[model samples]
Target: MGILLLKLVVGLGNPGKEYERTRHNIGFMVVEELARRQGVVFRKMFWFPARQAKCRIGEHEVRLVLPTTYMNRSGKAVWGAMKKWRAEAADTVVIYDDVDLEFGGIRVRAKGSGGSHNGMKSVLEWLQTKAFPRVRVGIGPKPDGADMIGFVLGGFAEEELLKLEKVVERAADAVETIFSVGTERTMNEFNQLQIG
Candidate 1:
């Protein structure tokens, strides 16, 4: 059999204790869960805040990355990895939090517009394309008159926190399915999943 190509899975989030457990940092949480499942550890990289790991799921070789560039500047790290790995857009998957969807929900897209996500916007800007796959984790919309930034940066309330774990785990599973079965299959299987 020919050698398998390397796939890059990027989880976008800010790096710091202040942002930990925040709705916006759900990308980081999902990546952490992915690492934990694979028994891998994240280490700091000079070019970007990242943890690198090599793992095999079935017959495919995977490299998981968690960008430490925070949100707005996430593309820099993502592009860095893409170039380093020589991976194509089809082989890249980006996971991030989405304010447009309901809490504890997820949407997987094979390729589409960024839809006002700064982290995704950055990735598109750096890569110069929107052909990559993305898994969007819903954090829900802001309450009446609430500061959007504050809402995203703030951790989930006790009630929401209870449901967040299930969301994260599901996100990780969706990602694995994306790699194994392709984006279209993963989307069909995961998009209909409801969380309460």
Candidate 2:
């Protein structure tokens, strides 16, 4: 069997400048890194409430999308992008923040339940599948006394912010690796790295 070439990559996050630097927008951050490395600019499309960029990694044509429908409605953007590009669940990848893992960690899964992420849940609902690829960037667990909403919406601490800079870059590299290699190989290589 051949690897499903990635046709679309969606970065799940809330839009607007207010949510720009929050932990919940790490997915957005990773896509920005990808855009920078690929020299592509994302334009807000009127058809979908999202920003999109078109580019190629080697011979694979790819679309990078950032959903603007807040967190819960992220699936609408993914659905729109998938439809516009004629991409299937197996040909798309979603990158987002994960609070369950330690900060600076990266994990790639071919398919799984959403776990505790409402964004992923929204995606599963709209796409109607548990078989797409996903790249999870850990935002660390919430601190004691912090509510889930507040913690995810909050900005990273200064020290963690420094570390996150590298993690974001690595996440971008991981996405590229998925296109160059394949999801399973990328997962095995990245999931074993010890990042803070």
Q: Which candidate number maximizes lDDT?
A: 2
Candidate 1: where are CA atoms >4 Å away? 47-49
Query: What's each prediction's TM-score?
Result: 0.95, 0.95
Candidate lDDT (C-alpha), each? 0.87, 0.90
All candidates: CA RMSD (Å): 1.3, 2.5
For residue 178, give model 2's deviation from the true position in Å: 0.7
Model 2 residue pairs with clashes: 103-196
- Model 2 lDDT, full chain set: 0.90
lDDT of 1 by residue, 1-196 (tens): 8687688889888888888889989988888888889888877777555667777665677888888777898888888887877888889989999999998888999899888888899999999988999999999877889989889989898989888889999999999898789999999999988788
Please provide, for model 2 over 1-196, each residue's C-alpha lDDT reduced to its tens digit, 9 standing for 90 to 100: 4553548988999999999999999999999999898999999999888999988886688999999899999999999998887898988989999999888999998899989999999999998999999999999878888899999999999989779889999998888898889899999989987566
